[model samples]
Target chain A: MKSKKWLFFVILIITTPLLATTIEVCSDCQIKTIKAALSVAKPNDIIKVKKGVYKETNLIIDKSLTIIGENQPTIDGQLKGDIFKIKSDKVVIKGFNIINVGKDFANSNTAIRVQKSNNFEISYNRFENILFAVYIEKSSYGKIINNKIFGNAKTEINSGNGIHLWDSKHILITNNYIEKMRDGIYLEFASNCEVVNNFSTKNVRYGLHFMFSNDNSYLKNKFLSNGAGVAVMFSKRIKMMNNQFLKNWGTASYGLLLKEINDAEIKHNIFEENTIAINVEGSNRIDYENNNFTRNGWALKVRGACYNNVFKKNNFLYNSFDVSWNSKMNDNLFEHNYWSEYSGYDLDKNGVGDVPYRPVKLFSYIVNKTPETIILLRSLFINLVDFSEKVTPVFTPDFLIDNQPQMKPIL
Target chain B: MFKILKYSFYDLIRSRWSFIYLMFYFLLGVVLLFLNNNLSNAIVTLLNVVTVLVPLIGTIFGVMYYYDSKEFTELLLAQPIKRSNIFLGQYFGVAISLSISLIVGLGLPFIYYGLFISDKIFEFLTLIIVGTFLTFIFTAISFFIAISFENKIKGFGIAILVWLLLAVIYDGIFLISLIYFEQYPLDVFSLGAVMLNPIDLARTLMLLKLDISALLGYTGAVFKKFFGTNFGVILSYLILIFWTIIPILGIVWKSNKKDF
Candidate 1:
């Protein structure tokens, strides 16, 4: 009798199919609502929402299901509350247009909020005019991909983020467009994430703002016309590659601001038309290679407390300032970078210049001492001051010179 | 007081699931440190992990500790013991257990460094203290939340929300202010904000201890000018103490007045 019961249980377990049922939701049908369909959704089910405006707020997804919208179905918050609140594992939300997330002074409200969940896929969505377009918190192993997020954030007090992830791990954010938000992409306490192929423009603040995150990779992203390009703070083991930072022109802005970032590999990037290409402070053990800086105000600005950084095989083209250092302590190395301003000749027909290149400008020292004198940038007096300083090596570190400068541009 | 402490500690110890969770965190830290080559890199990564995970663990554990022991707390309340002592004992017990797990998980790596590698004993010690202080601050906040809310889920939710506000949203707001007032000197404003945020204060203190305050540029210089010296460090410590103590005191007051 026991053997027969066990056999029956085994057959029941084996014969049960693990298939997900598909449900369709529309704006005008008898069911007529995404929430109604979700209410009846079982675990591992799929809800397909048709293209129409569904005004809803605080929609919760607790089951391991897939919510896919057709032709970018619009989920308007109606300035009420959060659009979708997800708290389930193995969920996928894709192909939706979300907008008008309510602004709350006390809460970091978002169009889509994923909380304490795992293995989510948020892709191919359009988010606009929201406080925060999509927010992932205490979630892991998620993908935020191919989304268009835009917001008219006039002030930081009233505005939130475009795509914000907090305390989440193993996230992949790729191929997205973000514009005119407080931050295009913001991560805090989020680790082991990969950000790639995103274009962020016209943001009020940073294109990317991440703090206390580790083991992250950013590749092939374009950050343009933002207040600041990117601020990577208190992070380690970051890999940045082949990105373009352009037109992030502001008095206090840069192509990148790295604070307390360590063991980063920054390679094959381009910085064009920014006020400053890279403003590095408190960063260490970074490898910078094969980058191009064109028509920037400052190519590299190294503040104090930076240590053991290496610059190699980079091209600096027509920048007002190549390098600006706040301190004389020279722990970093600059070698084999192509400088368009390099006046040294190669006597032995070698590609390397015979004389070392001094990247630190005399004008930068003068401007640091006298901030009002920055207006004299590109003036003949500044050029003469720079030439005299180069001849006499005053106000700049004597040993802080880039040896092995390339005779010609690398590319 | 003794009974509360004994029961709290015993409860934490008896929970094999929590013990496993702590071990998982420890193993994760160990794996990350092992994979990274640079000591500074490892320290940074470890600090980040601790900052994220410790607060969460502290909040959840604290909330659960209070809610689960409601019956025991009521039983103790029926006795002749003072509520403050009971609260203190429970608080101390919870803080002690979490600190032990954190020290074992995170502090052991630094101990290994001190034993075999460079003599960065002072730095390691400072790091551990900062980590502990951060955990304590969150624990105090969690205590307030646990005492205030009748529903455990709501209390946990509020704690998480507060953590997000303190850890992430504050910085976002500061950045926005800086952008809005780009022409003005934002040093004073930023300094004020930093003073208000205990998390920022702890981070600043840790970075200062690491002697990397200069890399913070104008912000670091402002902090140094205001709080980098011995007196400044003391003031910072006082501020952090106030942040931790005031909330716990508030919880005590609220708990004493409650009709539980």
Candidate 2:
């Protein structure tokens, strides 16, 4: 019995080191480079890289392993191709500062490219001066957290996005600081992504852009001073909550641009000092509730073909124009919102106004036709024209009215 | 001249219309602050009022004060005062008194609401300075009109007409011209047009300070370049001083050659 137990112990001791191994890569170690370490690593192995600059490019990781940087080791791609091409499943990359990936129009150069991978994590890294920070393609069940991406992009045609995802599913992009990129966080043909607690500012294009993506939700993210705030185009069932779209001021800038989007829920967002708070085009069944539009040029500029949308419990405060519709046909419902310009009294002591509020003004329509007419925005002549239009349905839409306008702001 | 200015300033302050005007602005400030409870909103609302109503009141009150005090002016002319002194004194008197009413009336509510400690202090200061400039410009222009036409009806008619032209009709023509020439760049034209009208100039200054000049399109950019920076502010102040000076010079020139 003692001899049999000793044999079992000897067998277990023999097989234990083969299951997993920790390979350390430093200047003095036997595994002198990460490439050499990764070459010998098997599944579930950890390759620890010590603090140094690695001048390598197009480094492909095909084995299921963990790569960790001690003291934030630098990965200088030397303006070559992608730094890390991740193709294996269950790979983890952490604490690497990546810089100077190659710029190629046809290749879509990125600091880290994860393709056809699952259960991957790219976290606690800094990406700078790269074309695309993190490109995730056809990947699922990944988490991108606490990454800072800074790009010095000037225009849309030449610049790339901070975080670009295509055909990815079930990804969480959280707590990333992205600045001066083209589009801060871009998703195309991607779905089921949760973007939370990110700060995207001063981008050349939209801060958070969605094209043909669905079931995506963003919460508590700040889009500040981007070219235009957030653009959700050609998508459905998207939810945006508690985000701040602030100070996107220009002739063509807006807090949120919705084009051909449907069944979206936008709640508790704050739009402040944008040229237009929400520019809606051909969207349907969207619900905008509890959002505050403050000091914008136009609180809501709705174009035609937008139907079944409801704006409720929102505070439109001191915007130059509350709602400007391009067409006279009205199908959207504006209810229970408090407008600072509503001049009606609630005689019945109910919280609603006795007279319905018509938010579109004649000047807004005229400005839509002739953009230069905005120079006459607060002129007395425009006020006379607006007052006349309010008294009689002339140029503005006749049926667009908020019948239950609140006397005070709906908190 | 000093005595004349003092008496006229004191007299205008004691008048019933001055009290009413003061009361009007006081009430507006109180309602905008205490009722709305939003300092920025109140400032916006006050912006509209200051741009439109201040010019109107300046013109009406200047014409009325000139016509109502014709006898007093004639009496001062018969005394030892020079013609330029009498007219300049009265113009300064009306402009200074009206400005005081505006500042004090609006300042009370804003100070009460803690504007001193707020970030909007610069915006409020801009508002005050713009209001004072409007008062001075319109008052000087009205005095020029009054002294230019000896007939009371013509003076009053032409004063209101001048205000209407600057406040409403000039913008109408400006908008029409911009639309008619939409194919061409209107940046220089719009900038020149704004400089020509004191009201538009004031509005542009305030809008730039409020940081919404980006909404003004091409002209907004130009105005921002000419009015958004420190050089712009100094140049605007110089131009505004020029606007005030030109009208006052007209008053001095016209009043000097006239016989009462």
Candidate 3:
């Protein structure tokens, strides 16, 4: 009797695929619309949409269904409202070109809004001119991959983010290309997420922004020419690695802006040609290693009260100002870094300078005090003053020196 | 005018002070580049030296050349040349010689340092051009001062005073006013003030090249729009040319009306 029951369970497991039906929706099909098909489909069914333009809005999917598109079928929202609203678990959406989601200032009208859903997958979709593309709120264990999001956003107020997460956990966002949105990706109160292998460029605001997000790691991303750059604020234990921050040029802009962050690890990143490479304020216990800061106006501008940060094995090449601090006291450590302007000799030739390298210049301090004195930059008077100040420390932080500056670049 | 220019240029180039000036620049360039091994820092140092020293040297050379050439001027006045042609030719001769010394002296070391192949070539070019402009402008102003005054000592003293005023005191007054009127919007005022002074204008141009305009965070938008764009660069060049012309016109006017 037990052997017969085991055989019956095996038969049920094998025949489940045959029990689930695949419904096709196209222009000439009997189930002509996605809404009609969704109304009739049961749990664990697949809704395959063929190549046609589907004008729809406020699509509510509340079942465990797979909605797949053939030959890139387009869903046009006609500027009405959100296109897909998923409130169920184990839902998969793929291979659709969604366009023209509405912009409502009072509420976030998104292209795809996932709420309280777990184990969902949103991949291989294209979004054009969307307000908020693939916004996940209070969702967990979801994967957003290989999506192309583009918007013609001009201002921060009227547009929304490309990929926005709020209170979402354990999310994986990878291989996405996003541009010209307010922010390429934004996370607020999200934790334990991984963002990898994405390209973000030319946004009106930050390329990637995190606020109060913890234990998140982003790797191998490219952020280029945004209004600002990437910003990490009020976050803890985040890891950022192998990212390229390029050409973020503005008066107040930086390649990475860290404020109130704690215990973060930033390694193997490239910050090139930014106005300011790294702008830190009130951040503590951060480890910055093996990063390259090249051709920036100011490589590092540290504000007051930032402590216990360790900067090691970084290359600072050809920047106008290698390091600028606004305060007279420093609790941070700079060691084993390669500064292109290091002038001390190493007689033993062990690839490290014999003397300490003071990165701060008195001219930077004067510029901070009287910004108008910047007109005197490159002036002989300023150089003379700087030389005198270097010989005898008067204004700049005397303790802010790299004790072991490398003789060569930290390749 | 061309013949007079050729003769005076040859005369000045072969003189001792010109060689000393040339050697001075060459030594400064080599020391800055070799000691610092930094192209950007060298440019900054070159900028400061060029701005302050170029005007002073130009003024001193102009006054000395005028006084030393008085006998030659009297001899040339007896010739068939027009008075304006002689004075303008001599002015161009002194200006061109000083500019060549400045350029060739600075250029050799920089080119040796691979500045032409570097991205800093534009900034270096701007520095050279501005230095040349300052030499010409200050030389012409000194010529005007020398021609206006019969007494050589008075002309020399006043020319040096003019350099001191424009190069240092004018900035002091400009800063005082900027601080005094910090409540008001000073973009237009500062822009106009910078345009009025050649040294300040040259400094502004260099700042635009070095990308330090971004450090001027509050009023940077105006400067960026003005100096970051192609049209603004052209406007600045036009203004610089206008500055060059006014002093030349003053020289011609003063030279023609003088009772030589």
Best candidate, lDDT? 3
Ranking by lDDT: 3, 2, 1
The best-first sequence of candidates by DockQ reads 2, 3, 1
Tens-digit per-residue lDDT, A237-279, candidate 2: 9999999999988767988999999999999999998988899
**For residues B146-226, could you state the per-residue lDDT of candidate 3 as single tens digits?**
988889999999999999888877876776576577667666677788889888788777777776667554345676577
As for DockQ, the candidate ahead, 1 or 3, is 3
True contacts kept of 3: 0.27
Off by over 4 Å in 2: A1-19, B1-7, B10-27, B79-81, B151-154, B169-193, B218-239
TM-score pick, better of 2 and 3? 2
Model 3 is docked with a DockQ of 0.29
Winner by TM-score between candidate 2 and candidate 1:
2
lDDT of candidate 2? Answer: 0.89
Model 3 per-residue lDDT at A406: 99
**What is every candidate's C-alpha DockQ against the true complex, given to 2 decimals?**
0.01, 0.50, 0.29
Best by TM-score: 2
For candidate 1, the chain B TM-score comes to 0.90
Per-residue lDDT of candidate 2, residues B110-197 (tens digit): 9999998999999999999999999999999999998888899999999999999988898878887877988776677777787888
Report the lDDT tens digits of candidate 1 across residue range B56-110: 6777778778888878888888999998878877877787778777777766665
